[model samples]
Target: MQQPHDTPTLGKRAALSIAALGVVFGDIGTSPLYAIRECFHGEYGIAVTESNVLGVLSLVFWALLLVVTIKYLVFIMRADNDGEGGVLALTALAKPKQVRMGTPSWVLVAFGLFAACLLYGDGMITPAISVLSAVEGLGHIEPVFAPYVIHVTLGILVGLFLLQRHGTAKVGTLFGPIILVWFCVLAALGLPQIIGNPKVLSALLPWHGIEFLVENRAHGFVVLGAVFLVVTGAEAIYADMGHFGSSPIRLTWFAVAFPALTLNYFGQGAHLMANPQDAFHPFYAIVPHWALIPLVILATMATIIASQAVITGAFSLTSQAINLGYLPRLRVTHTSSTHIGQIYVAPVNWLLMICTVGLVLGFRSSSKLAAAYGVAVTATMLITSILFFVVARKRWNWSLPAAGALTVLFLMVDSSFFVSNMTKIFHGAWFPLLIGGVFFIVMITWEEGREILGAKIQGLTESLSAFMDQVLADKPQRVEGQAFFLTGSYDRVPMAMVQNMRHNKIVHSEVYFLHIRIEEIPRVPNMEKIELERFGSGIYRIIAHFGFMEEPKIATILELCKGLGIEADLETASFFLGREKLILGDKPGMGRLRAHLFLFLSHNAMDAAGFFDIPSEQVIEVGAQLEL
Candidate 1:
């Protein structure tokens, strides 16, 4: 049954906002650690000067305002899918029920898929960069600590991933407080610097940024790729809407996050203007010498919180993909009894751990990873703008010109950042692109392979009405117990039922053809959850509707069916499921390489009985081999 999306009560709003600090703003929150430093020391870095500092500060200010504040906060967050927001949710909102290949709708789906793929790329880098950058603060404490930086980073990352299985319910409470203090400290540290160099406030003006770009031109454009780092987690505001409602996120950003980040960035610029050599490590330099170690410890905690948020997001995205059939199902264990969205996928967790650790050891420094960081996010932002336009026009009833104007403005900003980041492709930017490309291929292959396989399996089914008539004519012996045969489509006779009739020569007294339909929305209402059709002669068709955010529990489904006047006794019921074996051949389908890839994926996919929480002892699998 579809349940209404939960909304925090007025009293809980403050709490939710605090929690938002840890999850939604962590990545962007940690940017102050290295953003300004990168602009002067990264591979594409320029000299630190008065005008350059002002220009970079202005660029950072405006990028946050335009890209994050206006684009994501004020506008795009509204394009939610039943209170769930993300690239995939947006994809679901934009996709039509019947999308043919090579159509605009199909292209939109592809765009969403690629955006999601980029998120996995973003997911891998976020933890590596956030944690590494945080731990790198130790080097600022003492020159003696410099050599141990990589070892400390690897240890911290390993420990973090190891804690994933136990779930974050216990430690999660600390996230809000830690991140809150982190942001508060950011403002406290930067406020004094901004006051010292009051002229830095002029960066609030767009002309300074324009002048920087106008003067520096190509180099300034490249610097934008670094500046883009400040708003890297902007998508989190939208992606995590399902976890914390939009109101809390918006409130937290405007009230706590936005002001704190602005002060920190401007403070870094102001400090840089005063002491140019400190550009080597401006964020740590801004702090008093006595507080340096404490700050580093705090920064490490904040970064770890940030990494946890991204890892959780990866879990959510993968769960959504699996439900949508764009990826194979994996074992999903709910981490919290109170929250369905809080889950841990073993495969996703370990895969992310390997990649994140590899990145830390390879890049060796946060500044290096910064080179590859912004591309995937900018690409995702660009794609989001495009999808938002589609939703604005079709779903929101906005006029084409109106949606086009708003989208074009976002596109211009996103495209500029995307192009700037493009220059970093040779300087370690290829990593995310390669990761995104591999994930995109896998997602598309799974989706297309399912279609091909479903088509072939579909052809093997007999007409339900004809098959029933034949059974009636033959007067087959009736068994005592009820039998439920799961089928892909409601009108088709299940292959399991067909095979059972041929082998056993008896039909159960009460038989049901069960169809589970996974809907695009996050939740389906209970009234519309189940459709029970009595086809007569003890044969019935049962369709259970589930939202993407939900997992189908046969016990719950059967109970709901009973409530709807469709009798079901689970203890005596027999469940029949189909097991398809793929054989690569010269058939008119996918290529042999892809066919084998699909087979490998299918082999690893979680069994349907376990996925649906069916009783393994009561379930029977009817196997069939199909040439693809």
Candidate 2:
């Protein structure tokens, strides 16, 4: 085997940082399109006085530094699970293996799952708002283009979602260069304005934000719901850490994203200070007439890249949730063979597409969708801060005071934002919360339902050694071919095997009991992936270990077995799988509603044989009644 590589060279780091700008910064990169506009013209927006302009700019500035820079890039991004970041990884890191319900770890995991679910809502709203805001530029260009804004936005969205099937690996390469140009334009647009009204730079201080809040009093706090938009995509930075290592991401942010975003927002501030009436379209107003068309085009493409990042994030989180058993299995298509991170989930993609398009039609404007955007992300960030506290205490072994002090600081910021967004609960913000709530229910119900089903199964199945002894004593007719039985319980005989012995009264010449276990890490090494145990009389046990980011496949398991010097038949091997017929509330204790929901979810889940990539012709599914 080739030796492990050392730290990457500076040239490679620079390349990775540039690539990171595409996928990692895409969502946050496009914030300038609408973030500043919302703060001044949103429902609770204040008059665009110079001090107010400086104040709003100050708020946006500090939000990026404290929330995105200090809390996330400097801190939470360090909580990666074996080089993987995101709530899923944080959940695994914070929650130990085999933590029981009602424990702190268990509660944290549930919260983490809810946070993950909230991102889906964020995902749906992002594309609609991002693309609509960019496309809204057409309305600024000419009266005729204004009429077709919605139509053009819809067409682009449809095309974007349809492109998912072909995968984003190739599209991703173009994202870096395009986004790099977009950021440069943001900086360029802002520079001259800042030069003209350099006083807007005073907003860099914390006092202006405080004064703005004090002067506007209650209204200022409410407009914070809008100001939160500047940092709305902050979570994406941590979520994509696995794709680009943290160093390159941090480097890209401080070097490229931070400078560009700062200049643009300040530029917008400077422009607003001069032309207060342009508050409604500050981002566009700064554009030179000659650059307007090209800027709009770049913004639209940039927003598409933003939408692509979140959509892919939704896919990655969904896959991890399924593998970790928080959600039911779905059809996961690996879009790139070289990178496991590049995935396409059909159901997630279509669902997002429908919701996003519906949001555009229903909202009719980016300003309306903007109201729905900040709530989910603020709540998610709040949860992330809470989870980080637990991780620092439990994993890093930090003293309570140390953890509490840092956590209190984060919570103060998070709570302020969360409370501010709460005011808009009815003004379109309820949509994503409702979405998050429904998924949280689905996740918890499925987890509890599976536990109940496992308990029932445990009672029905006998010990493996005892079953083997009985089978040996019976001397049942040994079949001709190799047979594989997949089970969740490592030591208990599979229900399918039990059914086969009861009816067919025969065992295969070579019997393998296979149990696939998903570990908490992102990827399992091949050396420790598959473990085989030999039992006399042609019976064996095979255990396959996978990480939450990986799919457990039978072909891969068999290949590993071959590596271990256990060569089985290449063809004509039978694989036995259990087809569970769940009897809702048959054993009592579980609520009827949740039980029914779990049954519905289980029924809709993908088939085991197909999920594991077993040959259809060689698959045999034995039916069993499972009580929940």
Candidate 3:
């Protein structure tokens, strides 16, 4: 039998590239439906004259080339942390090795966390906008369908989200074939328009775009808010890099997605140049009349795929957050037996569905939701640029001049987009800002609160050496079976062990202090998983390491302990755990309001036994109260 790694060939890579098409390009691929239309008819839209149309098209061309093609695909994708790419993963890599180094680490961490929060906002807006844009194409088929656009959009979105529980593996096989056809249709529909008026090709040069901005400086600046819509989903390419390696993502983008999108965009521009009256819905109008209805059906399917990508991304990000201790533990169900990353988070799923539907009902149109969409993505892009700068300078050992130069260019572009989208704050961009802000608060509160609670609790415990000597000084009744106490701090004795000795006055013949450590990386090999230290008097200390990508399972760790010469039986051994009930104090540490909030979070967090996969029948929970 051939090993998995030895089975690779060119065909496998090509297949992975095809699979990349369905999830990675869904959002940006659907941009042609409204990107060109928004340029001339959105809130900040300019006139539809020949010069203005070519100017806008020129700007779109370069934005895609520089921002998505060069900035992300060429540069940012090179900054992956241990094969994991995302705002959080990049932040973890960028964190300074020395705590006392220049530019405090907390500042970089804060920026990264805020950026992750904004992505949640993006997750909410993507489905609403992408699905609505696809369904809105129906309005062009018949004027009578205008009233039912929202109804149809909501139905499609609800049905799409409801299917998330079934896992993406089932339908993922069709994604490549479906999106492959969608891109072909985009190219097929746009080729004729591009050929009809070769003048649209003139917009390819940067001078046309620069001239447009110079001719209409103030209006052009505002128009960038609309123009930014074309590259809204570019970050998904980077966020999903771990799903399909950078090779496949890059090949798919350069070969298929980028070209099809550019042709379609230029085609829409050429169509407008020839017939300026079709500015209302130029994308569908460019299609042949007989193919309009079938095109709408295809577009709807593409949009659902786009929406599915974001929903799936939200689930993955939440799982990372839970494992990293930035959020409360929620019940995570692995939807696939083969792929550990294929997970269904019910709370995140339902919450996103509710918010996505509410956004559709509230905004009522893709154009309106577009106003709220760019801010989150732009903010995330800006933060990614910043984090990338740090990683380039610190991790890659790049010289100051080289790192500073490229980062400054990226920052300048990102800041321009950020400022342009900032103009729409009052228009409708407040929705994402509000959502990101709420999530940011919750994440920060959880992180900071855990640190303070850990410190306070650690202060109350004695050192492990001292506790061991005390136990030696006053010997207790020794039982036959082994006992394992799960603890957070390895330096201090676990509260469960202390309470057990105080009440029962007995210790197991073999007592093990097991500390489960979640590392910053994605996965840790099983060969390096367990570290054992035997203290005197039949007391042993074991530290088990797991990556953020691995679910911590106590039973697995216990089974592995046999290799280290520790005798254990799952049927007879007992696992001890501490359950803390947080009490809010009138002190000024976290303040009363935040303290009470942490208390509530602690009370509802998943118990350790369930989260660590410890069997309930072989567990003992000792309850205690801690004041914060």
Candidate 4:
């Protein structure tokens, strides 16, 4: 079977490109619905002036230009973790070669994972806020729809969430053309207003944003909270770069999406400036009465596609986390084998559905939900900016001066947005923070729990050389041929091997001490596959590294070892796996209840035989003790 990272054929590439236009562009594409309009006309107590509109638009335009275009498209995309992007990918890139237990590198990886857990909060809120806001446009056309809007939005959201299990292939075929037409229609709707009042184009000037910031200094800081919405999906550009190469996304943005979005936003600003009172539903009002219903339907479709992108993103992130050992293994179902990225996790899907529905029900309107949206995105963006700086200095080998300057610039922009969003904490933005807080706690607890368990195992472990000496001294029965033992930790020898040595008193002529290190990178290059160190007398210490994006199957590694002159026949090579049985004690930090729960969960985890894809006949499980 072909590996997951194999380059796509021409036909697959074409299909994926179309899907990219629809699914990938959804979140950013739907920004025109509220991002531009709300900047001047938000529910918050901010004044709407011509300069403010221009300034807000200027901010939006430059944010896209600086953060999305310059930072990610130009600089950060190159920081991809072996064709993958996002916090986990960055963690893999930044992970230290020689990890001391509690070093700064390990802490940074934990920080990255925390950022990822926080994204789940953003993921839930984005769909809720984006879709509801779009559907609320129906209330503008007919007042009767306003009463049932929340229910209708909830039903539609649930339906969309339900559709995830079926995969996006069939429905996704309509995304590219629909979004393409949506952008055209969006621009076309605003063209007359923009052309009529050409001054609206002045929003493109940076001075207007500066003036607005100077004049409305207090409220302008608050506007950053609303303005941050414009770039909510900016990180998706980098995260989804592997699906469609940086070339297509860059081309799509400049060639089609950017210009159209700018025109629509400018047109909206023009409509507001020309007739402020008439700007109540300027987007729909711009369309002819006969076309209003069709426009609403199109907008709905666009929002659904955007939600689909976020939902799929959650699945991909969760999978990456599991593979990298940050998360426990969950049931992962391949939604489409033809597309390795198309996957479904039932637990995650259901959890998101519950949270999203709860949000919609509680907030009741997208405007209310909007307050909770930007903070998480901004926080994640801030984390990305920090990681990118590291990538610039270490990976790209940029000078300290150049890297420091770039880092400062990004930090100013990202921190400004983060601080601005902080103003919304009391106004419903606290929801995502609460979600993120809970997730962060869970992640940290699990990580800390694992470390404590690993340390306990290390203390109980016996060295391979000492075990071998003990076995030879006993002088029992002697066996023949070479035996290779698989161990979880590099410090300890497998207990099964110790038992075998003690009983048989015969050391295999060639005993291999193998250690596998799965890196955080999505794809490990063939050149970095395996490293060998001779420990003397046919005893070789081998380290094999796999990336987070790649499956860690021994069979595949064995195939990979063909180049290293090592023949791995599973039937002949004994695979040893350690099973940790937790002994519950009075753990000081974690309460007795949590400790018991952790022990119960750990004990019932899936066996390594199936998880590691090793043959049952060739596998040996030795019980080890862990005190919690």
What lDDT does model 1 reach? Answer: 0.89
Q: Give the TM-score (vs. native) of candidate 2.
A: 0.97
Per-candidate TM-scores read 0.98, 0.97, 0.97, 0.89
Deviation from native of the Cα of residue 172 in model 1, angstroms: 0.8
How would you encode candidate 3's per-residue C-alpha lDDT over 447-564 as one tens digit per residue?
7788787787787677789989988999889988889998888878888898898899999999999999878777777878899998889999999998777788877898788899
Q: Which stretches of candidate 2 lie over 4 Å from their true place?
A: 1-7, 102-104, 585-589
Candidate 1 residue lDDT tens string, 1-628: 3212255377678888888898889989999998888898888788988899989999999999999899998899888888888999998998888775567779999999999999999999999998888888888788899999999999999998899988998888889999999999999999999999999998898999999999999999999999999999999889888777878888899999999999999998899888998887889989999999899999999999999999999999998899888899899999899866679999999999999999998999999999889899999999999999989988999998899999999999999999999999987888988998988988888988888877887798888888878987998999788899999887889889888888888899899999998898988887788999887778999999988888877887898897778778877799999988877887637677777788889999999899888889899999888877
Question: Which segments of candidate 3 are over 4 A away from where they belong?
Answer: 1-8, 97-103
Score residue 526 of candidate 4 by CA lDDT.
74
> How do all the candidates rank in terms of TM-score, highest first?
1, 2, 3, 4
Clashing residue pairs in candidate 1 are 2-524
In the range 475-585, model 2's lDDT, one tens digit per residue, is 999978899999989999988988998999999999999999999988899999999898889899999999988889888899889988778754678899988897755
The superposed Cα distance between candidate 1 and the true structure at residue 135, in angstroms, equals 0.9
Which candidate would rank higher by lDDT, 2 or 3? 2
lDDT of 3 at 600: 77
Clashes of each: 1, 0, 0, 1
Q: What TM-score quantifies how close candidate 4 is to the native fold?
A: 0.89
